[model samples]
Target: MMTRSRLMLAATFLLLSAPLAAAQDGEPEVDCENAQVQIEMNICADRDYQAADGELNAAYKAAMAAAREMDEQAGEMGEHYVGAADALKRAQRAWIGYRDGQCELAGFEARGGSMEPMLVSGCLADLTRKRTAELKAVSAISGN
Candidate 1:
């Protein structure tokens, strides 16, 4: 009975570890920057997305400040403000929805595969970088 129980336990361990072993088998074999495997590529893509997001946040803040200043100046000058600040807020919300939907759809190329997340991240990074440029341009135009 004792030998049988040990055998059953060993089998259970192997069964549980099968997926983990498969995942580990695909490891990058080096640092993420020089990643040579799918899993590492995904991780690197995610990191790139994160960096882009950080830059976008900074650009957005600058743009928002510029818009607020434009609104304030127009109000003080007794001119029609056109609600630049409010428009920026609304546009940003819409952009967030658009970006997420686009990235999710892009991920469908990889579907249930391990590469799906990498595809989504890459899309996000590309879109975010473009948005950052747009925001910076808006800030420059606002002269703020």
Candidate 2:
């Protein structure tokens, strides 16, 4: 029989490793059935998707920084730091979901074509740019 400490450690290790094991399985492949539509789809779709991903990453970092600043300011003001941190985290999560969904919807027109990737990428980029602008506005308001 294992000791309690050993059992706890094993549980922790399994929990940490679960995601890594799942990721190694890889995602499903996209199907491009129409050769004739591939070129247009690729150009129109992937560019947006790529752009959205880039924007999302940039905005995420900016939001994280802003959140940290807010927490520090709140601390200095003798306010609840946890509340500020939680708000920031919630905003970040919402932003990520919004960005992904917006990009995916933008690429819906080319979903089954070679252009699907391009459309999705382009959509993501455009949405990301928009999101970054919003984040900048928040920063301006926060004076951070």
Writing each residue's lDDT as its tens digit, candidate 2 over 1-144 gives 999999999999998787567647852223345324554456445544565567667766676677677777778877755365577668778877986787678668977765667766766767667777777766666666
Model 2 regions lying over 4 Å from their true place: 1-52
For model 1, which pairs clash? Answer: none
Q: In candidate 2, how many Å is residue 83 off?
A: 3.0
**Per-model C-alpha lDDT, please?**
0.89, 0.67
TM-score of 2: 0.54
Where in model 1 is the C-alpha error above 4 Å? Answer: 1-30
TM-scores, each model vs. reference = 0.77, 0.54
**lDDT of candidate 1 at residue 11, scale 0 to 100:** 96
Model 1: per-residue Cα lDDT over 2-26, one tens digit each: 6998999999999878757866887
